[model samples]
Target: MRSVIDIVDLSTEELDDLIKVARDIIANPDKYAHVCDRKKLATLFFEPSTRTRLSFEAAMYELGGHVISVPDAGSSSASKGESVSDTARVVSCYADIIAMRHPKEGAAFVAASKATVPVINAGDGGHCHPTQTLADLLTIELEKNRLGNLTVGFCGDLKFGRTVHSLINALSRYEGNKFVLISPEELKLPSYVKKDAIKSKGIPYEQTTNLEEAMPKLDILYMTRVQRERFFNEEDYLRLKDSYILTPEKLRKAKPDLAILHPLPRVNEISVAVDDDPRACYFKQVENGKYMRMALILKLLKEAGTL
Candidate 1:
């Protein structure tokens, strides 16, 4: 609990404890309101990450702690030739804990290597986004009332959807779970995800390009935008872009109890027609993110012996 660099590092007991604390925070915010009154959280964003940054700030604010942030690398000493490690060392002097998001893969590992204060990785390129994974887990448990034995469908951008990757890896350890990866051929789930997280374990899985065809069978549908910025050519982006959009018409084929999830700031990958469906859980997911962060902040501060 010293640093929340990865969800993979947390055991089942630890994960359960965190979820419990998060629930307690949601039910009784006043009990822990001043726990972090004298603390500070530093946000070091070496890249543009609006949602994650704001979520962390909101969580700390709810705990009555203060926050100091650098919006991006260009606005800070990072633009003046200061190394990330060097910047982290300086910020540690002023903050109780650090949360960083960087464009480079494994950048958080580099920061934690140098930071004296506990460091949480908001994201590190496409390598991982562990805190978001925590949020997703919290949302899933709230929406479904449980975690295991579900058929989860991952649709779109599986090729570069780090959230999808982290979620699959985390959920793979639970019992009676299966996966359906729906994406264009060019955007199929990565080999490591298939081999390391799915295929080798004999976890029942199927892959297809048709979202409509996949809908009928899923307990949870996790949608990700097609990530146009990751495209190399216009033809490729044009070909695969709309292959994943979720609309109400298409969703009619899905089970009534099916819960739809998304790592948002979504574009047209999800149609407005589907927003009114009781199954659409993205907005609720956003609120759940705050509760999860509240739990996380409490755990970290407690572990640091500050709360």
Candidate 2:
């Protein structure tokens, strides 16, 4: 009954093994195409999504598995006030595994606690998004040739960005990895994240309001949207939304091989002109996410003795 509720739930060794599996899937697609034939994946998305939901469905379909999904509460029994645990208990009977995205924190944990099958936390409010971190790790490994000893810069909404929090927590376990956090003062990385992930692990990090000044020193730059949904005040959101737009001119100071990543649905944070630049690997990241999800499905099913 191993479940991935957080990125750190899987150790560095486990992540490396999954990355190896993902690479094998990428290289030998035909051999592993039908590994999960007749298996079913249940996607219980209590929130709106485009990439995460589609990637999970795509992953299952690619592995020859069927998907039964509740894309949102409007179309599910949740509209009748059904509980997450009850939903999990029922869906477990139908699907080999479950991937959930919810608007409330720890909702996936609640589902996994009662489900008969393995559960993956897709995106739980502002809590964590482990699968996205997995995709990020794979992309970094492919582009940089190694995960450790790189200066990674994270820019934009650090406060509400679950992807930022999860990736930092995952990367902190590696050797010689430091972070340069670039964000507006209001959206700086939370103190709890600073204490647990960076400080407790002895991972060095510097905070900055300037993206350009941090560019040349970074081996990787991860950009994020300043989410309008996370803000209580519309005026504050308007003031900060365009704070760190990454443009071609600003990238002139970066290293030639610096990998630029965005857990995207880019709302003008990254310029369209930057897409032509070799450093922008966000689109490649989307494809890598599907392969990583496929690897994860195989791993979890094997652990559950369902495959």
TM-score of each: 0.95, 0.95
Per-residue lDDT value at 201 in model 2: 85
Q: Candidate 1 residues 83-176, lDDT tens each?
A: 8788878988999889898888887887888888888888888788887888888888888878889999999989988899999988887788
**Model 2: lDDT to the true structure:** 0.92
Q: Evaluated with lDDT, which candidate comes out highest?
A: 2
Q: Output the lDDT of residue 5, model 2.
A: 93
**Against the true structure, whose TM-score is highest?**
2
Tens-place lDDT digits, model 2, residues 252-295: 99999999999989979999999999999999999999999999
Quote model 1's TM-score.
Answer: 0.95
What lDDT score is found at residue 229 in candidate 2? 78
- What does the lDDT read for residue 143 in candidate 1? 81
Residue 51 of model 1: what lDDT?
A: 83
